[model samples]
Target: MKQVIIIGAGPAGLTAAHELLSRAKDMFAVTILEESAEIGGISRTVRWHGNRMDIGGHRFFSKEDRVNRWWAQRMPPQGAPAYDDKALGRECSLTAGGPDPEKEDRVMLTRRRVSRIYYNRRFFDYPITMKPQTFRNLGLAATAKAGCSYLASCAHKLPETNLENFYINRFGRTLYGMFFEGYTEKLWGRHPRDISADWGSQRVKGLSVSAVLKDMLKKAAGKKQEADETSLIEQFQYPKFGPGQLWEEAAKEIENMGGVIRKNCSVKKVHTEQGRVTSVTVQTESGTEELRGDYFLSSMPLKDLVCGMNDVPSSVAEIAAGLPYRDFVTVGLLVKKLNLKNETKIRTLSGLVPDCWIYIQDTGVRLGRLQIFNNWSPYMVAKPADTVWIGLEYFCTEGDSFWNMTDRQCTDFATQELLRMGILTSASDVLDTHRERVKKAYPAYFDTYAQIDQLTAYLDQFENLFCIGRNGQHRYNNMDHSMMTAFLAADNLLAGKNDKAAIWNVNTEKTYQEEKNESGEGGAI
Candidate 1:
């Protein structure tokens, strides 16, 4: 039997294990080595005093039917059809312990999405809704400026070279300066001009100022707007408890299938010989041990993986080292009460709006975003009536001053920032606070991103070495995209051939198969 060693217990690695074991359980021995004690990497959920907090907000939505089906098979959707007790040859009723369908469907929950942008002490529709209230807040002067700038942009288009140019070309200079510039600079810690247009193309594709304006006009006229595209879906499925529940369930299933998962095993070295990965050396509390495997899959950061390899070309190492990542810090503040004081009136925070999260676009504050855990799911809070948990997200570079701050210092900083932004009246309103720092939360897509192509070419030479997942591939992919790559990788392993090109193209637009017209023309209908 062939032995497979998978590194990192994130979604991608776990998905690969589940797929491989399901198909070739008798022919392959699969073992997963995770550096952390937990299974989910960034998608993990943290429980504090019976409340759950997602490391980063993850919405389980994908345009791929296969991806959705894969999740459904493992964790069926709520209210999906199930075998009745009579059909299962059971005499007792469901209430009498005869197979309760609701109990069986415990993994996923359907949720509606509500997110808005909080800027200049006012809230705006996240996708830029135009309402009388929005115009009133902006005043006639700013509104005219935005409208004129958009008209000018439509008449005279600018060349889209970088992120800055992309936003200006689509939203015009005035709106871009007001909405996109500050928050983006805060998140990336660099001017938008330095960032590549690829990031903008991938994130905000199909969205344009004209489209938003049309939707707003329709809303103002009391006419129904067009349905949102897949990229702008307003509803999604989520794992109960947290995203961690999904991976934890997968880990249990893997163990049941005789696959091994080693937690707290840090990979120290990847041993390669004869242009193939022979084994991996991992360190644990006991000591170091080398495990031989017929195949290897890595979900660790590309830079660390290349550095830990036994022998690599200097050029590859240099490219890996040059890859940059943005670190993340989330300060979860537990509050006893929240009050919103606006010019019109002072009111309790409840019943104002149901927003899962709010982007902070105000230039006066350093906070990039705020997540309302309660809005995500009531279960996210220990006692929804008594306390609310809000996550203040900040982006920075590793080893930076903010990243190096102590937990107490960071929490205090968040509290003050909240007060400064008028989200909190006083620090005394906070009941408790916890802080978590995640390194390499985002892979940088700057002008230097072309170096990743070279790195990928070098890594592809190793027939048995497969790099999958976000940080593993050094791409800013969504969770579903990460799983898709893993699925393709498992297919390659099952076929006993390396198809690096296929794996690399898994999430790109070019990989999507367009529908055929009646005349057999291959184009999207």
Candidate 2:
């Protein structure tokens, strides 16, 4: 039997391990190395004081039936309405004879995708819908300016050379400045002009003001819009506890199939013979061990993976060392309630704002986005009926001033921002708090990223070494896209299809890359 070594116990690696074992368990020996003690990577759920926090909001809505089916088989959809739906007397689509979420923990619940933008202490439709209330909120002058600016943009399109122009061509300079400018800078820590237009093409594919207006016209004419459009997607699936539950279940299944999962084991080095990978050196608490593998699948950061290789060209090594990444910090706040009101007609528990998350577009505060944990899953909060659990998200570089602040100092800084935004009245409103930081949470699109094609070409020479995942390819892929890469690699390997192009080509089609998502919808990957 050939030995298969998979690095990084993330969704991509776990999916690869499961697919391989399920297909030909006796033909391959599978071993998974995870750097963290947790099951999921950034997709993991953090627990604090009996409450669970999803690092980033993950909505299990995908255009791919294979991805949806994979999720359903592991955590069956709920046959009965969930707690919030039952309490609110709300209706939801359910699967027949599926597990009951109220009685079982291993069930998936149907959830509405309710996300909005908070700018200037006002709430607006995330995609900037055309409505009287929206215009009223923007004020008559700004509305007219925005309309004229959009017309000017439609007349003379700017060359899509950078991320700023990419957004300007779609949303117009007026609305782009009002919406994308400051918040984007806050997220990437760099102006959009410095970032590549590929970031726009990869994230908000085909989502433009025109698309939103067209969808509005269809809805006004009594036609139900398709879920494929970013603005019109209304429903998605989520595990009963959190996304981590599904990954944890996947990890267990991998172990039950005679696969080995080593946690707290970080792969520090990859040994290559000629152009093929021979073994990897992993570091653990006790000591270091070297394991040989016939095939190597790495889901680690491309920068780390390439830098740790035995030998590499100077130019290739320079590009790998110069790869940029954006770190993330999520501060979980258990508050009694927020000052924001539920003005919308959508009914929610405790008459709370129905938004699952609000993109913080106001540049006054450093917060990039905020998540309401109660709306995610009733089971996530310890006391959902009374307390509102929220997560304040900030993007920064590792070891930066913001990232280097102590947890207490960070929590206080976040609390003050809430007060400044009128989301809270005082620091005492915060019942409890927890802080988490993740390195290389987002693979950035600047610096040496322009020469990535050259790097990939060099790495592809290693026939037995396959890169699979967001960080593996440094393409900022969504969760489904990441899993698809692994699935294709595993299937091709089983069929003795050795060419690596198909594996590398997993979400690279120009049309698909520019039209499917708007940067993963500001949700979990």
**Residue 118 C-alpha lDDT in model 1:** 82
lDDT of 1 by residue, 153-191 (tens): 888987777888888888889889988888888888878
lDDT of 1: 0.76
User: In candidate 2, which residue pairs get closer than 3 Å at backbone N, Cα or C atoms, i.e. clash?
Assistant: 203-517, 203-518, 203-519, 204-518, 204-519, 205-514, 205-517
TM-score of 2: 0.95
How many residue pairs of model 1 clash at the backbone?
0
Compared with the true structure, model 1 gives a TM-score of 0.88
Report RMSD (Å) for each prediction in the order shown. 7.6, 3.4
Score every model by TM-score.
0.88, 0.95
